[model samples]
Target: MAFTPPKETYTGKVYTLEIGVPPDTVRFGGENVLPLHGFEGIVPSRPVIAYEIQDIPPDDWPDTVKKPFKDVSDDPVSWAKFCRDALKARAIALRLIGTHPDRENRSPEDAAKTVRDILSAIDVPLIILGSNHTEKDASVLIAAAEAAKDKNCIIGKAQEANYKTVAAAAMANNHKLIAMSELDINLSKQLNILITQMGFDKERIITDPMCSALGYGIEYTYSVMERIRLAALLQNDATMQQPMLGDIGMYVWKAKETQARPEDVPPWGSLEERGIAWEAVTAIALIIAGAELLVMRHPKAIEAVEKVVDELI
Candidate 1:
């Protein structure tokens, strides 16, 4: 017999989703093999990185990461346009951080208007996110989803505390949903089951099993993602088969390695280069662990990740 390579076969396939209006859309998921294992099965699309922007000025962001958007960060619409026109971002995630009760405490109407403006400005896919205050997100995200109605956006972060409201809004607006759960396989599965139980289609869901920074429990995150993927592909667990979301920039940029100054950490080298590497490493690791979609901040980090994806695919 001719020598043959043994490849693990998978029965389950990730749900394919399209975001943004037609003529300017991106597709993700729909793979039958392990990440980057194209020889074993089909990998229809490479993972996508969506540049992350915020509804208000990102004053909280550290100076290093904040420097790139210094000119446009004051206006969300202008920041989004810069990402689309200059940075060539494939997708844009507009996080309504201003709506947080502690932050600007912007009203739902403010969130809605911001969505409308960003949608009008950018043709790439939009990922609408709330300030992540569970209670506030229930209302804020509802307004944002309705604002982007019929645009095929991904309205997120329906956690255990607020899945019903967010899921209903996404369902009502005819958009995709993101179900987030703490980093546990069982919790992830349970949340997915709960969302689908509320009459939302499971095929339209994306699983965000809460990501972590490179040093802080990233291995735990890695293992959870790996298990989720194995459950989806090997065991054919329908509840765990939705595509994964890394949300890489939020976690990666916060780590000490990314924020520490060269004067403080002489061994780490340049702060800017260190931050970029921090994000790129985390993103690549997640992809290997089965993340099909990512939301990132730094342009340099995004460029590095895209280069790696190009080489792998």
Candidate 2:
């Protein structure tokens, strides 16, 4: 008699989404198995990684991550083009951090113009991100959605404070919306419900249950994401079935492990390699936990995760 491996069957599947105009679009999700467990069920798409850029120069970014794009970083268009043409990015996420009231306080129109310029410069999918200011994002993302209309972008980060307005913009412009909540599975599901209740199609939503670096409550983040995935796959919960996003770069790059100088922390070795490893490890953990889309910085970190994804699939 031949020995047989036990395979678990899941009833639910993640919604498949396509971003960017056709011929240049990327698709993800539509998997029914646990992450990387393709042998157990259908796994039509591997995870997608988007290189993170910004409307303004990445001045706040640490030297290690910022050095790579030093020449083009000053101009958003040039920065976006460099990522697409030189870095071979699959997708680009333009974070409108300059629009924050405390930052440059750029007007919505300024953000819209930046969106148009970057859209014109790059054919790959674009993910338009606000500066995580709940109030500012409501207005900024609305303008950005209009500017990128019909180009098929992903407009995000509709949190509890501003999901209605942001979700409306995404709905009006026909772009995907990323519904984010704190690191709680219940909150994530509740936010999704609220968005869909507004007549935004649930299938077009992506769940961002927030993100954390490796040593900074990453285990909690991982647990929430895994439970969400399990709820979707095992319990067949429709509210939890949307694909997840791990905004890896922002969180990973901020951690002390990524920012500390080797001289200051002699045991950590090179700062650059340490930063890259921090990002890669964080991203890989989320991917295993059920993140179908990742927004990451550091070419080497993205490269490392990409290689791992290839091997896993």
Candidate 3:
């Protein structure tokens, strides 16, 4: 006689992807500790909306974008305060765009002083950015890092070309870092691996999968981020798990979808309203897709995205 045993079946219901970090409580300078990874805990950092300010006047910004900031465009410290006090910004990302040799060619001292001045003015956390010029950033981030010592802020988008010095600064000063790659998983992983090799801890690192605004390869950007998240959870890839960072404002504000004129495209509605919606929609998509921290621009966009986050989490 053949004996029958219990039969087990597998269910197809989707399991949530819990990627990135281990279950150990991670502390940030001893105050707040994040529980788990992957969309964990009140965003722990409330999706920091960093009002973007360049070291010099933003000439390349779209005219419509420039008009809103026209009054505070000249002074960096005043601009920093405006974003924090008036605009109600949670944080600020000061991009030293002027430091690029090809741009105004401002020196490391200039960058350092600006960082010092802004830090003095704003009580909120700051994200000190480089000019996006690889060679210049290597120098600027170090000076800015030294200027911001003990502040415990974030310094970054440290790429493969310049991670050594930047990583050292962040490590020495006890600050967070943004690891950037050119929208490639391998590159992102490689950079993260290299940075940690220099002794920076995992929690101190944030991944910039590199965001693109709507209509301009947003799908590709989103797919890359979503895949990074999936890899972290399913495969338990540590490099992929570090809290994902999105530069929503940088991409969204520059995209045509946010810039379409009412006269040119009647269906898009008011430019300002449409731009804000575009940014919020892009940001919300990222949060749902697993973004922990965001560096955004528009006030309305931040408010809208925060509400959606409140509902989702």
Candidate 4:
């Protein structure tokens, strides 16, 4: 008798939802709905890539990293074009960072005009970012939502701190909204629940669970996102089911792995190389853990992450 391995059970494919499902088309003017879990449908909308555009020059960014965009960074519209034309950015994220109180505190009307300029300049999907300050984002995102109302854009980051105004604006204007929370699973679900309770369509909501750099509590972030996605796909948790977003560039660029100076530590190699690696790796990690969309900076980092995405999808 030929040696035989112990009989083991074989089960049909369990249908692991490695890929997200794009939401059903709601026919909201020129915009398309993005789905997270395959339960929504087929096609995950190719995991949207939103190229970051700052309302003001990113003076806070290190010189090594900011040098690439120094030329076009002078103009927000031109910067948006560079991302679309040169970088081949599938989506654009325009941040009105200039409206912060310490900054120009530019009026909401001015920000709306800038939105018009950017909307006219590019055809790809647009994402409007508030200055991250609770008060400023509430006002600025409102203006952005109105300006790009029919053109089909995404306005974010409705948080517990400012969800009332932000959610109202995005819902009124028929734009997708990102419900953001600190790096906690419960908070993420809670925020999504609150936003939907406000009469926002469930399909139009995206979840931002907050991102952490490579070494800075990344494991916790990963676990939180992993649990969220699993609950959505397996347990069919409505609040956690919305597609998740990883603001990779923002956190990675601020971490020690990306900010370490060569002068201070000779062991660390080139700053450019380290920074790119940190961003690329962190983004890939998020995808593995079920991030359906990402907001990133740096051309090289984008290229690297795109390659990984292509292979996985």
Q: What local lDDT score does residue 169 receive in model 1, on the 0 to 100 scale?
A: 99
Model 4, 1-313: lDDT tens digits are 9986543222111111121112312121111122222333344345666778888888887665687788899899999888888888777888888888888888889899999998777676788888889988898899889998866577888899999999999878878888889888888888888888888877677778888889887887789888876676556566666777788778888887687888877799888899998888988888777776788898898899889867665
lDDT of 1 by residue, 148-223 (tens): 9999999999999999999999999999999999998899999999999999999999999999979988898889
Per-residue lDDT of candidate 3, residues 127-223 (tens digit): 8989888888988999998998877778996998889988998888778888999889889888989998888887678888888887777787778
Task: Give the Å error, residue 96, model 4.
Answer: 1.1
CA lDDT of 197 in candidate 2? 91
Model 1 residue pairs with clashes: none
Best by lDDT: 2
Lowest lDDT 10-residue stretch of candidate 1:
56-65
lDDT of each: 0.92, 0.94, 0.74, 0.76
Whole-model alpha-carbon lDDT for candidate 1? 0.92
Off by over 4 Å in 4: 1-45
The better-scoring model by TM-score among 1 and 2 is 2
RMSD of 4: 6.1
Candidate 3 TM-score over all chains jointly? 0.83
Candidate 2: 10-residue stretch with minimal lDDT = 117-126
TM-score of each: 0.98, 0.99, 0.83, 0.85
Best by TM-score: 2
Candidate 3 — which pairs collide?
A: 20-241
RMSD to true structure for each model, in Å: 1.0, 0.8, 7.3, 6.1
